[model samples]
Target: MCDDLQVSYPKDFKWSSWHVSCTCFLMMTLKTQSELITEINNGQNFSSEASENFIANTPGNFNAWLSENRESLEKRKSKPYFLEENKKFVK
Candidate 1:
């Protein structure tokens, strides 16, 4: 049938309704939004000295360097350092 061909139907095709279930099933194989955000944030903690060194080596604007690395920095910002002194005693 036409399904055996690699061609796709127009977006407005009525038959596209049937593909919705298949799409949803495939989507389930990927991580959810919150999990993806958490994974990217966790990845920031592992950025290497080489990465920082690369940014430092850039010839122009430091702001551009920051913009390029913003996602990594944002992820790094989300991590909190735990220390004994920072703990609050519950009354």
Candidate 2:
């Protein structure tokens, strides 16, 4: 069950351990660590657009860049690209 579902569990489970098997089986239906990481990466990629836009909208000079893109940068940071993504697995 663990291997099929790609999860971590105790390897020394004894024979006739129905509870262990049941728990492991139940865990199989849940998302794995790799799945969670993949979800997070997708979120970061989604947010990267905001970051890229911030860089693109900046002026040539540092102060001008900060002044010009301050609002947009903050708005981008506030966007819950990752939060919205993680919420998908909330069920």
Candidate 3:
């Protein structure tokens, strides 16, 4: 993931904010994908059991989960870049 991130966003770009945001976004996406893949593998033999719990837990389950939890979706709510973390956006 780090390798991909580094390759995707060159270090010398003038848009430092864009580079940082893109790096964070890519990392988060990679994490989510890895987690989903792990879940799929672990549930392959007991898909029904896992599906039952997942369905019972969330009202709309998968769709609602993805909709609410997607970083990519939330990213579009504002500008493509973010100010430094640990502080509010200056705007």
Candidate 4:
């Protein structure tokens, strides 16, 4: 929502390119954190096979990683430095 794209949420509120969103104003291509990680690893952000395995399944693998890291991630989200919308909900 903070980004340039205007988003609208419906009752179900589960539309997503990678994560959740309901509607989008402009044509937007959103990438999951896993995808970004995969790209970075492939492009030499860090050279390792670990990143390869980590993002091998695209959204599913990254989503699992998110589940695994939820507690620490919640703590990070609690910080004021995070976005206001994210402050309301962890997702």
lDDT of each: 0.32, 0.35, 0.35, 0.40
Residues 1-91, candidate 4: write the lDDT tens digits. 2232233322222333322453433343344568677777888554333333332222443345546766776687353232243333234
User: What tens digits encode model 2's per-residue C-alpha lDDT throughout 1-91?
Assistant: 2233232222221223222335433221234456557768887333322321222221234234335655775677463232233333212
- Which residue pairs of candidate 3 clash? none
Model 4 CA RMSD to the hidden true structure, in angstroms: 14.5
Q: Using Cα atoms with residue i matched to residue i, what is each candidate's TM-score against the true structure?
A: 0.19, 0.19, 0.17, 0.23
Tens-place lDDT per residue, model 3, 6-90, is 3222122223333433444332112244555777788843433343223222123323434554567457655433223312312
Clashing pairs in 1: none
lDDT of 2 at 62: 28
The better candidate by TM-score, 2 or 4, is: 4
- Alpha carbon RMSD to native, model 3: 14.9
Q: What C-alpha lDDT, on a 0 to 100 scale, does residue 51 get in candidate 1? A: 29
Better of 3 and 4 by lDDT: 4
Pick the winner on TM-score between candidates 3 and 4: 4
Cα misplacement distance, residue 74 of candidate 2 (Å): 0.7
